[model samples]
Target chain A: MKVLVPIKRAVDYNVRVRVKNDGSGVELNGVKMSVNPFDEIANEEALRLKEKGVVTEVVVATIGVAKAEDQLRSELARGADRAIHVVADQDIQPLQAARILKKLVEDEGIDLVLMGKQAIDDDANQTGQMLATLLGWPQATFASKVEIEGQTARVDREIDAGIETLEVDLPAVITADLRLNEPRFIKLPDIMKAKRKPLDKRELGDFDIDVPTLEVTETRPPSGREPGRMVKDVDELIATLKDKGLV
Target chain B: MSKILIVAETLSGELHPTTAKAVACAQAIGGDIHVAVFGSGDQGPAQAAAEIEGVTEVLYVQHDENNAARAATLAPQVVALAAEGYSHLLAANTTTGKDLMPRVAALLGVPQVTDIMAVHGPRDFDRPIYAGNAITRVQAPGDFVLVGTVRTASFGAAGGGNSAAVSDKAVDAELPSHTRLVEQKTGGGDRPDLQTASRVVSGGRALGSSENFDIIFKLADALGAGAGASRAAVDAGYVPNDMQVGQTGKIIAPDLYIACGISGAIQHLAGIKDAGTIVAINNDENAPIFEIADLGLVGDLFEVVPQLTEKLG
Candidate 1:
């Protein structure tokens, strides 16, 4: 089985995000960048599937500018056999991203698509399901565990009340949740080997992927988290809550 | 103008609270509000959705045993039912809703705006981004016909003004059969789920160990609240990832959120911002958590927790 894993590059989880002075988007002045956290889980799971012989090849895919190639190399270093880079700066949203990816999947004859539930930068949590829709394939999101047997995938998902088990056939999309697996750090030898792995890049125009602007938008600082007075004790806390009618 | 559709989801043949929230948002958009449902069980949630303040008609699209699971198989089924005339489609931004709605948006080839706190003007929304550190006003693409909304604590939950009429319009969903559900082995905990509970008590790495994390559990028990954790607590191997509440983690909006030992980061705050009242307890005097706290305490969690526990004890 061929496994296609989608990865995204965004600001490091540790760095604080600030609104751009010009207000177009986030201010990326000087911040660390890394693969979106949940994507790491998907990558690790895809690699494990290959190791267990459940899958034969793992193809890592991403949509971004040229700079995102570094993250693609990192994914290859982590264990993907090859990479597909859809190069474009279309300011694409998750739906458009899914459209572009659906074409890639059909072109590559991908049997399964593994992705993070959401990107930390936008936190939209839209791509996997969106791609599943575009492809008319079954999808499972926020999956903590995925077990494959024959042409079906049995997954345990982390929901609000209790865990729900879902079953889907092959040619499905599964988004990784946090407990899926712990991501592995790239060892030095593997890093050296990854440098030699070939990365193939294709422009969005090359594939004739049409992306239209979805929305006119501006970003602003998150609202309603103002500072409050510190309470001295539980009594004060209770009193304040009562005064605020929050208890 | 065509009406907006709301997918009222259910579990155990009952209406989940988020369904009511979705109904309310449908009402807020005000027009002909249509409620849709699936599953083989009773129409409890659909009936409930119809009764919501603004939902006009409840449309049931339940299939046979072939698609009993609420897995991604429900995507095509949902989009097909929603294929009729509708100006926009609204779904909760919860786990199941997230899995299904994006696929619906993809099917429609429209722009899907997620995690929307508010729908400002028609075809426009205000949603949080950058881990809730910023708000983006997005004008959706004209070609697509669906828009999804998020639970904004009060926005959707409070739009309960409509009484609905239940209708059974059988649909040929032809949902693909799902894999069989064998078993669900879950952790043993008396606490309610952090994402759905009205109140939550969270701990940070400052709790030191799992045993110490129990303090928050006891407090949560006393308050009948759910237990949550910061990424620090989860990354330190103090708790499971399901309990981690943040941007990358579960995004929750409880009525009351208590932070013990946590220094609120932007990501953490994003999940808890819609919380009605926030109380923070941390040793650092200048922890960022205090900025968002409706109430705060500066002290060591290890010492403070035991005292608070004993006092309640």
Candidate 2:
């Protein structure tokens, strides 16, 4: 079985995102970029599957600008067999991303598509399930534990209620949650090896996906919270809570 | 006027309260709101959905294949219902809605506005991005059916008073068999639901271990509050993922929120920003949680929590 892992170049999780002064969008100048944390978990899951001999090959793909090749190379260093970069300079929404991925899945003859549940940037949590819908395949989102058995995979999904287990046939789409696996750090030697690996480049226009227009009219910081006062001890805290009728 | 269709979230015949919050958003959008209850072996959830104040009708779609509420089967049914000339489709941004709504948008060939925090016009709304640090006002094209998920934390649940008409709607959509529910394991049994609880007491990594998490639960039980945990506590294996309260976990807007030993990360703050009055009980006086907390106590949770719980009792 072959697995295709789709990743995105997003703002580093540690960076504080700020809206631009003009209210157009977030300021990305000189901001640190990394593979989305959830996507890294997806890559880790695929690598573990390959190590277990359940997967024959692992492919990592992304849709971004020229600078995104760095992210692709980073994934290759982490044990992806190859990489695909569909070069799109402009920002793509979830629908277009899913359509492009659908094309890639067909062209690669992929048996499984594993990706992040949500990019920390847009936080849409859509593409994986959308791709599954377009392909008429089963989807298991927020997967914490995944085990492959013959032609089926058992996935433990984290939902609002609790962990729900599901069995989906092969050629399915699975979105990785935070607890899926902690990604491994890349070594210097592996980085050198990844430099020589095959990295194929394609353009967004190659997929012939009809993109829709969603306009961002403005961006702003959240409303300010009130300044707080502190109490010296538990007694004072209880007094304050009772005064506010919160206790 | 926009005609809205809300996909009611249900599991094992219980109508989730998140559905009522989505109804509140639909009411704000100003439409004839019809909620579709799928996967219910009986009509109990549908009847509950009909009682939401702004709901105009309830459509009960009962089928054996929908017993699990799998997205692969529900999306096609929702799309078929949207084809009935409805202009908008909405659901609450819980796990079920987050997993299900996008597929419905993909099948309808429309872009989705997720976690709608505010509504401006029929096609314009505000939603949070970058984990609620930045708010973006987005406008969808008027030509397509608008699909969105409501930020349940930002809106109150619609009151239950009006009795809406309930009808059985049969969809001709084909259901898939590739996905099957194996089982489910739920935690925090008999406790108030964290998402809808009026008061919540959450612990952090400072709790040390799963056994140490008992103090937080005991306090919660004493106050009749829900028990939650910060991502750090959940990551430290002190609690299950379902108890996590953060950007990646459950975003809640309880009336009173107590943080024990939690040094508020920005992501955790995002989940409780809408909370009424925030209280922080951390040994570290300079912890970031104190920045947003309405009342702060600088003391060890081990000592402060039990003392507070005893006083409350």
- Residues B1-313 of candidate 1 have per-residue lDDT tens digits of 5488877666556666687776666655567878787767576667677667766688876667523446445666667766687877777777667766777777666667787677666566777777778778888656467568666454636445566677777766665554445555445476775656888889998899988888888888877888999989988888876688887677787888989999887778877888878889998989999988878888778777666656544
Which ranges in model 1 have alpha carbons more than 4 Å from their true place?
A211-213, B66-71, B154-156, B159-162, B178-180, B183-198, B205-218, B224-226, B232-243, B284-286, B300-313
| lDDT for residue B190 in candidate 2, whole number 0-100 | 78
lDDT of 2 by residue, B1-313 (tens): 9999999997657898889999989988998999999864688999999899999999998778877778888888998899899999999999989999999998888888899999998899999999999999999875799999999998898999889999998999988889998998888487888888889999999999999999999999999999999999999999999999999899999999999999999999999998999999999999999999988999989999999999998
Candidate 1 per-residue lDDT, tens place, A1-247, comes to 9999989989988887888877788987577888888998999999999999999999998999788888888988999999989888767778778878888899899999999988888878888987887787877778889998899998888765447787788889999987889999988888778778877888787554454445747888766666678888766766676676665
In order, candidate lDDTs are 0.77, 0.92
Best model per lDDT? 2
Poorest stretch of ten by lDDT in candidate 2 chain A:
A204-213
Model 1 chain A worst lDDT window (10 residues): A207-216
Give, for candidate 2 chain B, the lowest lDDT window spanning 10 residues. B62-71
Clashing residue pairs in candidate 2, if any? Answer: none
